[model samples]
Target: MRMTTNANRRVTDEQIERARSIDLVQFLQQYEPPGELKRIGQSWTLKSHDSMRISADGRWNWFSQNKGGGDAIGFLQAVHGMSFQDAVRTLAGEDFKTIPTTQAEHKAKPPERAAFALPPKNNGNRRVFAYLHRSRGIAAEIINHCIKNDLLYEDAQHHNAVFVGKDENHNARYAFLRGTLTASHFRQEATGSDKSYGFFLRGSGKTLFVCEAAIDALSIATLRKFDGLDWKKDNYLALGGVTASESKLPAALERTLNTFSFKRVVLCFDNDAAGQTAARRIFTMLRQQFSENLEVQTCVPKVKDFNDQLCVKLQNGKNSPSRGTRESTLSR
Candidate 1:
């Protein structure tokens, strides 16, 4: 065993700093075993791997597994399954005397992304309409409004409900599918989907409302409508869902903040523990990243989620027990 001393401390600190500073993208190119890697803009997608998407900033997200991230050190542990000590030593450039070089140095070029495609449209929005309106308790007018705007539809094959996400040019960039059958809870992102442009509903006003699911976002709007609130004045965005290891805020949130000059952010996440944790984490990240003057607040539902609250309200009618007043427009 080696003895611990003050001189050893200086060497250990130097190793940590060097490991942390390694460029993740470059590190992958150098040390990663031969495999299929696809470049998506500045990020790289390991096609053969499990949703390993690495951004230029050294942050990574395993989208398929919903786990991710850290500096170059963590990347090694994740991608190569290295231990902390080995990963650190590798990044500190102390090892690799016997490791084979995988590839010659070459600059990567981003691949041209294919246009987003919606799953085949249903004969009519029949299944989706019934599911959202009758089962989900969303108003007919609200359903019709989304249908008319090309934001929601039913898939032709399985009759799943499709929620669309569009870029600034109004070109569809992502599609989220939800099952409509009773007792079904199937959900997935369509092929070629981009999370940066998640399902968004723009309103006439500047305040923004963010939620975890598309249905929850719509439920909040419906609730606003029921109260005769001007739901159309404020924008809404669904983050798709909360993942345990999502490192930063959703790409959708960042995009919306930059796209619109919104003054207030109301986080309407589900009322459960995971939702509460995500809301708090996102709130902290947004606060640090954006202007200090920007207002940020949480508006969790009284029930499991906004949809549940809306359903209860519909069931209770005017005789429903009084829920506490909410400062956000989503308050019942």
Candidate 2:
């Protein structure tokens, strides 16, 4: 077993907790992984990764993408000049030698996503994920990995959601606004906020995670790139917005049972007040739906949220090479 002396601990709950409270300082607490990288946000400009700012808000605001230099093996490998495997071992402590890297030791993964159900017309823009990757000045591997596994949302209701199909010019166009299905109205709610409805990524789900916003789900997808995780086999749905609505929560729980043969549901939400409240409510609904078969766990970012984190990480100074961070008049 790898044991660390009191002096070796890199992060502490108190520090992490403090970081979570302020959106400004959230990005700097990312040292959990030795291979961890940082990105800039839209709100921040002109700061380089090396000279990144930690605003009073506790966010790790970054510099321009051009300024955020690439590091080896993440910053860890760069500092240590080791191969990725050795860098991983460096982080693993003594477990480096004994821990099996065998394929057999790895968890048995679900089947790969063979059929990707692109919206007959979907119009969500994802250059944001890529923008975030570049702003943090993350490595090419990190950026490429995220782009490859981006998830498409298939289950959000109308008014708050729009579906897009292609125009004759091959440009993406909005197809229609969705209405509340019979399935939509049949759930529990706390504050009666229909704004927070449970969503499914792809209906025939097997493994699923739930969060509060489409942005949060996308953020999780962005984070998955760094963690060497995949979200396609593992699906994520957003509950629309941050309101204490339980109306759609139970509906999702039941579908998780009947429509999805899913074994797991991870509730990845913001690490703040609203998220905690919503997660608790959703948990109660889930327990009643499956009793034992459904397993519920919560995922929280040490900072603001998946999107908030990414948004901050990908701000490469005032502007990137192309669709860079929008130059705000307030920034000037």
Candidate 3:
């Protein structure tokens, strides 16, 4: 079982079963700890049966166990001393070109640094800002494509987070912090990497554009809000994943609401089957809230969402039958 580092590490599942089939004495004494297995991340101590210990041969050490298991990523962090990016690559056992770390770099553990929480300064975590900002840039084309269709943006109130081209400054505007999903659904998505259902429609205002989920709202605004189209300058809203319902939002957010000339609210949820049902329910509820006829129209994506349409544009030649309501179930 004890193999040299230069020796190829051939580990067959069968070999493991063979070892396991052996008696405790045979395993503890004769079985070697084949090619040096380096510990990753923190030490892992475990319980075993029948005096099962590898023949140390000056190379084996039992890792003292811990009650809590580290994250899989964390485990790699301890073993190879890798940074987050590098650790990702090492575990994958392949070149992750989206990163710069080589195998050696990944194996090296990151140095400890002081952890501190600074208040909201102008330069709050430039690294995080840069990453998210870049995501916005990559997302811009998709945004523009949406605008070209039929959506619109409210200009005046977008000062907090400015818009490009129309506003001149690169800023993020308002933050609509509501979801149709229960607080629990919103919490799960917010904590995870896929923060799609979000809209930061910053602007000064009264009228609003409301949708069922964050993704639909943001896409409607970013892709076409400024398309000089029919976007009625209402503050956009995404009711998380649910159509607007009897959900209560913080009064502070509601107090900030303003619209242009107070146009009727547009209930633009997805055009999916669920969206159709939700839109009908929302329209009935909202019509009662205002004296004006609240126009609750549903906007369905030709493909999935605006992003899917953008990808189709990118993949097929832009001039091909790839653009617009031509083949989508949306135009109807």
Model 1: ten consecutive residues of lowest lDDT: 1-10
Model 3 CA deviation exceeding 4 Å by range? 1-200, 203-207, 225-234, 243-261, 313-332
Error of 2 at 302 (Å): 1.1
**Cα lDDT for residue 192, candidate 1:** 68
Full ranking by lDDT: 1, 2, 3
For residues 1-332, what per-residue lDDT tens digits would candidate 3 score against the true structure?
Answer: 21123113344455334332322222222222432332211211113311111111111122221101112233333333455444333333233212233532343342232232111222222332222124322245434433343122222321112111111132222222211222211111111111122333433444465654444555455444223233334466543344222233212123323222444455565555445555565566555554474443445566645445434544554422334324221221
Write model 1 residue lDDT over 159-267, tens digit each, in one string: 9999999999988888888899867757667766787898999998877889877998898888877766777787889977653233567778888888888878989
Q: Give the higher-TM-score candidate: 1 or 3.
A: 1
Candidate that would win on TM-score? 1
Candidate with best lDDT: 1
Q: List the residue pairs that clash in candidate 1.
A: 205-233
Candidate 2: Cα lDDT at 296 = 69
lDDT of 2 by residue, 242-274 (tens): 333344353334443564476777777677655
Query: In candidate 3, where is summed lDDT lowest over 10 consecutive residues?
Result: 50-59
The per-residue C-alpha lDDT of model 1 at residue 204 equals: 88
Assess candidate 2 and give its lDDT: 0.39
